[model samples]
Target: MDEKLSKLVQDRVGGAQPVCLFAYDLDRLTEHVRTVVASLPPRCRMFYAMKANSGERLLRALAPLVAGFEVASGGELAKARAVGGQIPVIFGGPAKTPAEIEQALRQDVTRLHAESVLELHRISEVATRLGRIAEVLLRVNLAGPFPTATLAMAGRPTQFGIAEELLPEAVDTARRLPGIRLAGFHLHSLSNNLSAPAHLELLDFYRRTVRQWEREFRLEVEVLNAGGGIGVNYADLDEQFDWAHFARGLPAVVDAFPEHCREIDFECGRYLVADCGRYVVEVLDIKRNHGVDFVLVRGGTHHFRLPVSWQHSHPFTVVPVEDWPSSAPRPELRDAAVTVVGELCTPKDVLAREAPVSRVRAGDVLVFSHAGAYGWEISHHDFLSHPHPEHVYYGDSA
Candidate 1:
C-alpha cells in the first residue's frame, strides 16, 4: 500500500465494519467519457456498446452522453427503449431469432447490422410482411493481424459476416430486395490499439471500399460503420488512451472522400463505461497458511467477472475505515503476503494473487478499481444462486 492509499483506508473504513458493496463515480466517469467523445470529428457518431454494463441506472446516466446504442439482442434493445423513447439503437450479432427481429423492428431502431445472407433475407422478409422497410448495414470481414490477444473472436476461423470479396454480391442482393434498405457498411475487426497510421489506413480502406461500392452500384451510403475494438484500461491505469490523435487522423481519412458526407459511425463497448464503477467485497475469512496470508472475499466470478474474464492480474487499492491505523500494525500483528480468493467453491475463483496489504482481518473490505466496464454486466451469472449485483448512479441522486 502506498502512503496515499494507506491514509484512504484509515479515513474511509476506519471504525465501520467491512462488507461487500459497489459504487460508481458518475461525474468523473462521465467526464472521462465526454473527453473521449469530444476527441472525435464533427458529425461522427458513437453508439455505446450496451453489453459492457447494462445496469438501468448506468444506462440512464450514459444515454444523454452518446448518440445511440449498439445492442446485440432484443433484450438489450428493450432495456435501451425502457430508458426512454426514440433512442437511436442498432442490433448486431448473428442469427437473431424471429422474435428478436420483430422486437427490434417494433422498437423503431435506427439500423440493423446483418451478419449473414440468411439474416439479411430474414430481415427483408420480416420487414415486408410487417409493411415496413428495415435499414441495414452489412458487416464485412477484414482479415489481418488484430491488435489485442485477449479478444476471443479476432483470429478465430468463423463466419460471422460477409467476406470482403463477396460484399458486392451481397450489396446486389440488397439492391434487389424491396423492403430492406442498405443504409451503410459495417466492419468490426479485432484490433484494440488505435495506432495513428494503422488506424488511418483502416479508415482509408473503408472509405475506398465505400467509394467503389458507390461507383459500382450508383447508391449512396448514409453511414460508414467502423466497428469498435478500442482498448480501455485493462493492464495499467497510467496508460492514457490517445483520443486526440484518433480524432485528428479520422477526419483526414474522411476528408479524402469529399462526396461521401455520411456520418462516421462508431460502435464502442468497453471504452464507454468500464472505469466508472468499482467492486467492493468483504473479506469473509483470513488465515495464515504455509507462510502466506489468504483473504477470502464474499464475491467471485459469479459477480466480479473481469478479474477472470480478461485473465486480469491487477489488484485495487484496499483501504480500511477512517480510524484504522495508518502506520503498520504492531509487530505482534502477523503481517504477510496475502492472496485474495472468493467464496465460490471452485479453485478457479481467485481474485488477486500475492496481494501486499496490511494484516487483513476476517471482515476487512476490498475495493476493486477500474471495474465499471465489462466487469459485472458482461460475464456475471446467477450461478450458485447468488443474487445479482446492484448498480447505482452518483451524479443527481447521490
Candidate 2:
C-alpha cells in the first residue's frame, strides 16, 4: 500500500464510528485510464462501460479521459450524459424497452446495439415514431470453440445476442428498416478473458467474420463494437492482463483487417476500474471453528460480493491497528489459515476462505483490493438492511 492509502486506512480505523469503507484512489485510476487510452491504436476507440463502477466521482474523473461511455440502461445513459456530456455514448443491453429506446434517441446516443431481430424492428419503430434514424450494430452470438473466459456470454445458446445463423436475416431486416441504419456488428461474447493472445485471436475472428458478412450482404460496415471482456487477475496479484503486450499487438491486428475500414470500439468495464478501489472492513471478532481459524468482519458479501461470486479468495492485505479497546485477551492468529467472513446471517457470506493471514485481530482492517468494478454496484446492499459502507474518494473532495 502507498503512503496515502495507508494513512487513509489508518485514519478510518481510528475514526469515531468503526464503519466499512470503499476508498478509491482517483490518482491511480486516472493514470491507469490515461495509460490505456495512450496505448491503444488510433483506429481503436475506448469507451468506459458504465456498469463497472458508476460512482459520480469515478465517472466524472474518467469522463475527460475516455473516448466515450457505453451504457446498458436508461439510468446508466442518464448518468453517462450527466457526467460525460457531449462525449459519445453507445447504448447496449440484452433487453431494452421501447420507452428506453425513445429516451436514448432523445438523449442523442451515438449508437445502439441490437440484441435480437425483434429488437431491431423495435428500434426502427421507435426511431420512426421519433422521426430520427437510429444508428445500430447487430450484436452477433458467434458459434465456436470460443476463447476461455470466466463467464462466456456467447459461443453457446444465450439470450444475449442474435445467433450466428440468424444474423443474415437480421441484417436484411436492418437494411430494410426505414428508421434504422446498420452501422456494423457488436461481437462481445465473453467476460474475464485473461489471455492477451486469446483476446487478439477473438478480434481477428471478429474482423474476418465482419468481412465475410459485408461481402455476403454487400453492406458498408462503419463500426465494429468489439465488446469488452478484458480480464483482471484477482487471484494472482502479480499476474495481470498484459496491456502493453495487447497494445503492441493491436496495430498488427488492425493492419490485418485492411479490407474492413470499420472503427473498432472497446467498451471495457471491469478492467478499467477494478484496480483503483479497495474494500476496507474492520475485523470484529477472531474465533476458531472445528480447528479452522475464522476472522469475522463488520461487512460481508452484501458490501463486496465479487469474491463470493467468483469463489476465489480475494487477495487482501492486513492493516494493523495499534490500539485495542477491549481489556480482554484479544485473540490473534499468526501466519495461520483463516476464513474471512462477514456479519451476515447466511453461511454464504464468506469472502476469503482458508487464506493465509499474518497476525489478524479484532480492530485490524482487511483491505480487499481490485474492487472498484462490480464491487458496490453489483452487491445486494439491502440484503439485511445493514448500514451502507462509506464511499471515500482520494485526490478529490467527496
Give the poorly placed runs of model 2, Cα more than 4 Å off: 396-398
- Candidate 2 lDDT, tens digit per residue, 134-207? 99999989986678889989998788999999988999999999999888999998999998988998899898
Give the clashing residue pairs of candidate 2, or none: none
Candidate 1 — which residues are off by over 4 angstroms?
1-18, 152-156, 191-198, 212-219, 288-293, 322-337
Superposing all C-alpha atoms, what RMSD in Å does each candidate have to the true structure?
4.1, 1.3
Query: Which ten residues in a row are the worst by lDDT in model 1?
Result: 324-333
Residues 255-344 of candidate 1: C-alpha lDDT, one tens digit per residue: 776555568888887777777777777665676678766777777777787777677665676644333353545221234566778777
The most accurate candidate by TM-score is 2
